[model samples]
Target chain A: MEQLEYEFDGAGSLRQSGPAVLVGVVSSGNLEVLVESAELGGRGRVVVNTSVRGFGEIWQAVLTDFAGRHNLANLLISINDAGATPAVVSLRLDQAAEEFYRGEP
Target chain B: MTTTSCGTAGQSYYEANALKRITSLLDPGSFHEIIRPEEKISSPHLRILGQPCSFNDGIIVGAGRLAGKKVLIAGQEGGFMGGAVGEVHGAKLTGLLQRATEEGPDGVLLLLESGGVRLHEANAGLIAVSEIIRSVLAARVAGVPVIGLIGGVYGCFGGMGIVARCCNALIISEEGRMGLSGPEVIETTMGVEEFDASDRALVWRTVGGKHRYLIGEVQRLVDDDVAAFRAAAIELLNDPRPLSLEELQKEHGMLSDRLKSCSSAYDAIDIWHTMGIAEPETLPLLDTAAFHKAVQHVYRGAA
Candidate 1:
């Protein structure tokens, strides 16, 4: 097997839009999320690069579900994943968004 | 804090500085640095990125005698661009500690001064932290002491915080701090009001020696003076039995109990008050002897 490495970026290009961006610190078993403002267009699109192959569709489904649920759009999200599970991924993403809007969560 | 007498002279990689501090209390000339920087074993990923390299990569590894006891020591030098570890840096560290399981150093002293992985060699640094965790588990399997010595400028953030937590024990200098996200990152991610990036007191309270010791995350506290560091190292290293699996299981159980009881708006001062320390306000100003004499660690069984 090749290096199980990956990177994903979602431009938060959706109809319900505001300015938010997410940049995650790449660490194994954990991650850091930065969500913030971005230029419009390329909205709601997510890009992923990983050593772990064949998980693109899984990510697409998860991210799409996430973006839709948050009603988040017009933002850029960049992640550096190190084999972290969907739960940790979700937690960090949620924290980033909450921190972004300074929302209590 | 009294300065420990240093017998070695050179451009001390923070790694060397760490070992020197420990050895100053040990017999002179008893220090034996293995897989040293002079070997020129470094990260190849940096070569790909056209970055300067370090011998032992940025990690310094070795085994030495302190107080007539043999121990293994490793330190990451943040001085070389904040002592970030790349692939090779990670590998050598993970591998040597793995070996320590069999060869067996009385204790593992980590001179931690890191901001996490080297972004230039991202994946490798990440991978190495994982492997090092595995080695920590191995050390646990064999019943050896594993420790984190946090004082260097990088202040042990990121995965290293978890790594420090994984230690069988811990030692911290007042100047050292440990946390997941750094201050700058906290500012960038959570905004200034959520956490002012420049407030030293806020930073220290969040992850500094006082907070860590109050929380029972740090086993012993010492001054930044190298001699104080050496004395602390010697004391912890002298412990014959480290935390056993049964003890760890119990501690884990206690942590669960703590989490269940205290998850809401708990402040650091709340801990000091609960632990029977006389005055939370004066704890910071107390000397090492006074601090040791006055306060009680709420969690007692980690070391």
Candidate 2:
């Protein structure tokens, strides 16, 4: 088990954010990401909770890349990860972001 | 939505995921998931275990319409931990049934595809399942029909199997399997001589939909297609049958008879022979309609 957190200063603001947007499953090789609209002083914070210990560097890299790639800001992101690979984590993060930007279902 | 060779709508229910099953079972675009993935209401117990938790906790509970009538829906994600029920997952199901009792939905639909209680959180999961059973009984007493649908990779088993048995009606597909204990567990605990879990044919004959339907364990046996399932659900919704004491007694009698009749039978083929199904070995290969037709003449109920 591993817990990691990071904060990325960003300029991206959600279009019509209200409640948090959740996406993905926490099955083996899969993960779930929850992004909430929060006041982070123009920076987004991400906290990750995962099984399959000893992957702190990979998780940090994935979150950093996601935060760097997207214009996502004014948010607090949390992830519940299983034994997902770097690619899967990145995909789920993108999906959460996409669902968040799309507004309510 | 897509069409199949059988002319049913969308993907087959056997192939669809939990979310897809919920969406297709209800009216088009009518499904609304409560405490959806975005809500992030995961399991606190699992967090302590350091296990990854799903946003919706593997069970999607919400309200939807079937044939223009309001219905509560709960679909379990089999891909996640074999769709095992945990604290939050079981709580969501129990809460849905409780709300249904209060709000009085026309019917309740439980898309069951679980291996039962989560071994990771055994006590909490077991307690939650018991709560769900009580809630189901309460809902039935309130005249709210509870229906369980089992047709997935992980068919209903364990405590969830009992919950399904308690439902007023159960709809199963040929692909679905239901039992108290899974084959592997049985083989491991009771030895391979008692039950060879590796034999898929034997396993299916014991707990698959065909066998269950033949013995009148399940009410309806439909194809693996989503349209087939949706049609069955809609028909049942229009004609809800709330659980009753008489029905429970009848079921108990039937089970007693089944125990006596199958006491000497070692395999499903023996039971098939006893039931007078010709060429019993070939039954599993037959389609749903053909199998039902073959067994239609067999008398079911107390001996």
Candidate 3:
């Protein structure tokens, strides 16, 4: 397993402060994303723990693209991946963000 | 969209994840998870073994309400490690049952979808399963009824099958299967000729919900829909069958009778035939309603 961490500047904070929103599941070729409000000093942080090794560069590119698309200020995005592709990772991240913004249980 | 108190119509419980099952089965907005995913409490042994870890250790546990009644609930994520029980996952379930004994909830609903103990952490997982069984019995002894719902993709097998049987009652769907040994494991251990794992029809007939309900192994058999499961759970909470010495004796007598009657039976069809069902071959093709109608006359109070 490889652990990857990335920090990005936030575009804005979340609309509502609520409990964490989780999306997806850690299965073969799938991943789980947990998005929660945290004290990150106005910056977004993502921690990825993946079973697929030697993908640090790809994770960086995908996380960078994700951070660029969403306003992740004061949010911590933790991912537990099991060989998910970049497209699935991106989709789960977006879904988690949507759930977080909607304040879903 | 027509939504009931539990969830929208036509939502398949077999496809839903652990959290989705819990939220959809319970009263809307009533599930408050004990250990949130953000807390990042996962299996400690997985990382060292080069395996990706789930945030909540593949099981979600917390307090919730079923049809306006207080209840404690737990759901196993079948997608994660086949919903196998490890140290943390088992502890969470044990803790919840212990809480149920103390707080004395209306009931404890267990959404069991596990294949069994995790082989990666073999000893710890096995020990955890034992502890969970004891805790479940303890809660039942304290007058807290424990109900199990088995309709997930992975089905319930291995140690979890024992756990499900220990519950006061079980609500299963056609897709849910409960057995001590899984088909694949049997095929691997005793050759495909002995138990063909690829034969889905044979596997279902042996351990699936329809057969289990007909044989009285499960209390209720409903459709695969989440709404159906929710309704069944609400109805069952009104009738909690706590364990008793008389119940055990009755169960033992039923088991002995079954062994004597079915010892020479070749397959589940033969068992069904012995149970006095005419045209037992047609059972597998029948829908849930038709299956119930066909077996209404047969004595199904035995295990």
Top model number, DockQ: 3
- Measured by lDDT, the strongest candidate is 3
Q: Report the lDDT tens digits of candidate 2 across residue range B1-303.
A: 133243436468877778878887888778887877766787888878767777888899999898898999999999889999999999999999999999998999999999999999989999999999999999999999998999999899999999998888889998999999989889999999989988988888899988887787787899998888888888877777656677777778888888898899988889989988878999999998788777777846211
Highest TM-score model number: 3
Per-residue lDDT tens digits for candidate 1, residues A1-105, read: 112222234444444333343323333454434344555454533333333556666766667667755644445555545555777777777766765665322
Give every candidate's TM-score on chain A.
Answer: 0.64, 0.88, 0.93
Off by over 4 Å in 3: A12-16, B1-7
Q: How many backbone clashes does candidate 2 have?
A: 4
- Evaluated against the true structure, the overall lDDT of model 3 is 0.90
Please state the error at residue B86 of candidate 1 in Å. Answer: 1.4
> Which lDDT tens digits does candidate 1 get at residues B1-303?
123343433222233444345455345777666764324465677656544444345566777776677878787766554667678877777877887898887877777888877778777778888888889878867877887788776789887777888887777876788888888889999899778879877787777876777666777777666566666778877764555667788778868865755565356666666656667767777776777666644436343
CA-lDDT, candidates in order: 0.64, 0.85, 0.90
Q: If both were scored by DockQ, which would come out higher, candidate 1 or candidate 2?
A: 2
Worst 10 residues of 2 chain B by lDDT: B1-10
Q: Rank order by DockQ, top first?
A: 3, 2, 1
Give the alpha carbon lDDT tens digit for every residue of B71-107 in model 3: 9999999999999999999999999999999999999
Clash-forming residue pairs, model 3 = none
Which ten residues in a row are the worst by lDDT in model 3 chain B? B1-10
